[model samples]
Target: MATKLGKQTYQPDNPPFIISTGTVAGPFEGQGPLKDYFDHVYTDTLAGERSFENAEKEMMANACFTCLQKVNVTPQEVDFYLAGDLLNQIISAGFCALELNIPFLGIYGACSTSAEGLALAAMLVDGGFAKLVLASTSSHNSSAERQYRYPTEYGVHRKPTAQWTVTGAGAALVAGYGAGPRITTFTVGKVVDQGIKDPMNLGAAMAPAAAATMVQHFADTGRGPEYYDLIVTGDLGKFGRELAVITCASKGGFDLSKNYNDCGLMIYDTEKQDVHAGASGCASSALVVYGYLYRKMLAGELKKILLVATGALHSVTSFQQGASIPAIAHAVSIEME
Candidate 1:
């Protein structure tokens, strides 16, 4: 007996879809002068300073505004908004929506909000439920730390695997069928629980989720890693990236050590930033993909790409209860024609 399976292609029957498959940025970048301030404080050179949260919110708002402008779409034009942030109660998303005065749907995926938001928005477009949708995610180190773990004045040391929460935001608009890169593929992830207890070790905790989702994505799409120019994971950082490689190698019988890269590691050069490794948070990977790589693809630097955003599915309440941290990852494939 013989069996046959169908292959999925990028052809859309209705119309050519061009989603806000990309993003824009604001002026202020990550960390800012905090590193310099820390260095000066260590040497007793300076005394008081302003709060990083205020600065981060300002930067985030600017980023959101700039992204809205770049897409040439007004708030009224957007049918729905999907947004998330690292801050408690999603202040950034809330504030952004309040300022824009559009219908909103706030989400929480820890650091993986980018992929989740895009996935949901893509579904809406694909289902013909809405014509245009905007999705966004953001994170600020100061805000996240204060809300989840520690205070900025504590100056606590972090584990090497820990990623610095990115102080940025990224927004993209997904449109109905048009002429551009469409959300060609989506691999919904499953939550994988690993018995790692350390909150500081997010990379280790989330690595398994990234690995599981990547493997499932390849299996579902019936495609190999070679099909993509780049396979980018969200904020898995250095440790998680290595673990993901090991997981994929074990399952797929391929070495992804060289081809696999993590956005957490790429956002800020650790040596220059003195951030130990790199960045994390919801916006960490989102900004890099939307602001950097998307532009490169548009410029013909890349053809096909697979973006996997990983998140640690642990909250303050869950962590306190000694519940194991579960991680989730979502993947989307984009191609330029």
Candidate 2:
């Protein structure tokens, strides 16, 4: 049975294992520093598909397929498929699930969908309700921009705080026992609204939520910043990463300056890439956690890691209605055992 801790955290008695992972990156991401970490990189955003939306779905399906292929696990062997995306109605996840033909559980956590799915998948396996589960998420730059902000053809001037949506997908398979990292703890965050209404500044809106969850995770697990080899936030870019470090020190007295980093900052070379703030989207942390970090863990460089993926939960309708962005962060503690 999973043990609840400090109101929002859960420590699984039999921690679930992340057996395999798959990641696919887009052209722009292919030029990034961690480009070699990805299993596949698309030549173009379309990926031979007619529309960006279709291409996003293809990427997600391919990611899931890659995971299964690596472990020789058939789709029917997986008990459930948990996935989500930044698309309207989570169309990309839905289409990917349809292709996989697994029992599907669609989730929506904005950019935090990756961690959210992992947490739920771990819970199901830890509870003995599932033998194997697949968690996947994806985002496409052109498709997300058209739905959330502006169409690519418009070429609207972006603010300095605006982040580039990552065009990619990632998937991981969780099992009751496996030869990989173990998911020991999960911290679920509350929806926090800081009264910020600007849709472009997502990192600013999400930093508070990320801080709250990190604080709670530390308190619940009786651990501090020094517990993990590395602590990473999902898409808090250069500016928001600084804000998160300051907020953690002020609120929880936790100094994260030494071993902490953000996926948004690590995913792209902000100096070289045209991305203003950095990378943002479901695939931002997904690609880093499943590709780069996973490979490092396998090489015995990093034994433990804490991934806190944050999300700005606001829709086009809510933004237009002058509603503030409500953000959340889900934390997953993975350690090699």
Candidate 3:
């Protein structure tokens, strides 16, 4: 049985939930200035023939399958599947489900899908509707750019603050009951509108959302940044990270300048001109959390972590309309026993 730690009431019939396992990356590699940013790289001849969409599908499927194997759960044991991707129709998630042959609940949260999926999965378990749940998110640079912006061959100049879409995937298994890390709290975010209307400069567009959600998370939980070992933001790049620090300082009366880190900044050594200021995209936050930070937790290097997944909720159509870019963020706090 899962015990409720906080003052909030848990329904008597709520199912116990735990993230039993997870996996990341895939069997396809791309060489660019930012090649070294990824933790796992797949280099093989067969990967060359597949389109970006197909590669993304395979990556997501591999991640979910590996996660299931780690938790000793079969496809049939999963009661609900919630997933998302950066593609137009969430093609990767849809195709991955087809291969796994599991019932699915697709989601669209731009880059915040990982937390979004986790929150939803936790809810189902908490509602006693599921015993086993799987949630995941994936993104590929080539596919995302072609579908959302421009083609890779176009060679358009990007702003210095623009984030590099991560070519990776991350998945996790949330079970009804377990001794692993649990979802302690999910800070639901309000859409923060800073009225920035620049498609090329996503950092500016997303900074306010990150700040708003970070502040809200601290307030909702009645905890400060010192309560956690690490404070991580999803895909906010270097510029956005700075902005977030400043904004958070103003609102929370805490200087997060030294303690704050961005997944985008951690993914690559931008100083090497490999990827300018690291990685972005939906997979950026997921991979960093599941691959890098999760390992640290397992090693007892980190006990608590606050993860804020940020997203720019603007489409090409919305950009053309000169609509102010609205952004949303979701925060999830994880602690290792």
Candidate 4:
């Protein structure tokens, strides 16, 4: 019954099972290295929708419905839908909720929304508050660019340190009774700001938070680096992942060079894709975890996974107002056994 573990950590008495998962990607992602992991890939980013926001909503809906189909559950059967996206007011999640016609809880964790929703949904199911819950998140590169930086018509060149926002959506189904990987322990991270104000340089801003959360998870769960078969971070890209490893080592006096991978780096091939740093967005981690790694867990190739999802919690208004980017990361432990 005791769910709390250390500061900001939660060790659920009964870990909810990850019953099913779904992933959908755009044309660019379809051509990427992990293209086969996606359940559906759109030939166009708009998916025939007039607006990018509508496309995003459709993408999210496709993912959620795909997940439901996999488990033979209807939207009405899902007790709660906890979802979010990078758009202003989380319009994608909101519209998707309306279409799905299910009880919804809209969240905002930037790129970390996927793991954040998973952790919250698992808590609800494990606590007996709900028999089944849906945790979903999405992002579209075009939508994000138009909202955060410039309109697609402007065609601004991306910086070398900048990361391409992934155009994809992922959905995870958590239930009290299911046959799949279980959510074990989670470490909720605190907001970390190193006074880095450049929006393009998110790697430098978010690395500290990823490191802080990873170190806290180790201390709280008493699980060293070797305990997890893989340590995965969400949307940190290549540079951020490198700095996170170094930062964790310096803070916790342990090296994280082994069995560590970033979803951003794993989503795309840096050389092939024009993604400068790597991929970053809610779906970056979503597609990798739900699309790629979940299958690995089910195949017995992986047993234990420490998934740390990082988000740059900065807004367009905040950036224009000269506010520094504050990053946050949430860590969740997943076990196949």
Winning model by TM-score: 2
The global C-alpha lDDT for each of the candidates, from Candidate 1 onward, is 0.71, 0.95, 0.76, 0.92
Task: List the candidates ranked by TM-score, beginning with the highest.
Answer: 2, 4, 3, 1
Query: Could you report the Cα RMSD, in angstroms, for every candidate shown?
Result: 6.0, 0.7, 3.5, 0.9
Please give, for residues 193-238, the per-residue lDDT of candidate 2 as tens digits: 9898998888899999999999999999899989999999999887
Query: Candidate 2 vs. truth: CA RMSD?
Result: 0.7
Residue 51 error, candidate 2, Å: 0.8
Find the candidate with the highest lDDT and give its number: 2
- Whichever of 1 and 2 has more lDDT, that candidate is 2
lDDT of 3 by residue, 280-306 (tens): 888888877876777677778988887
Clashes of 2: 0
CA lDDT of 5 in candidate 4?
70
Superposition error at 14 for model 3 (Å): 8.2
Every model's TM-score = 0.86, 0.99, 0.89, 0.98
Candidate 2 lands at a TM-score of 0.99
The candidate 3 region of ten consecutive residues with least summed lDDT is 5-14
lDDT of model 4, residue 16? 90
User: What order do you get sorting by lDDT, best first?
Assistant: 2, 4, 3, 1
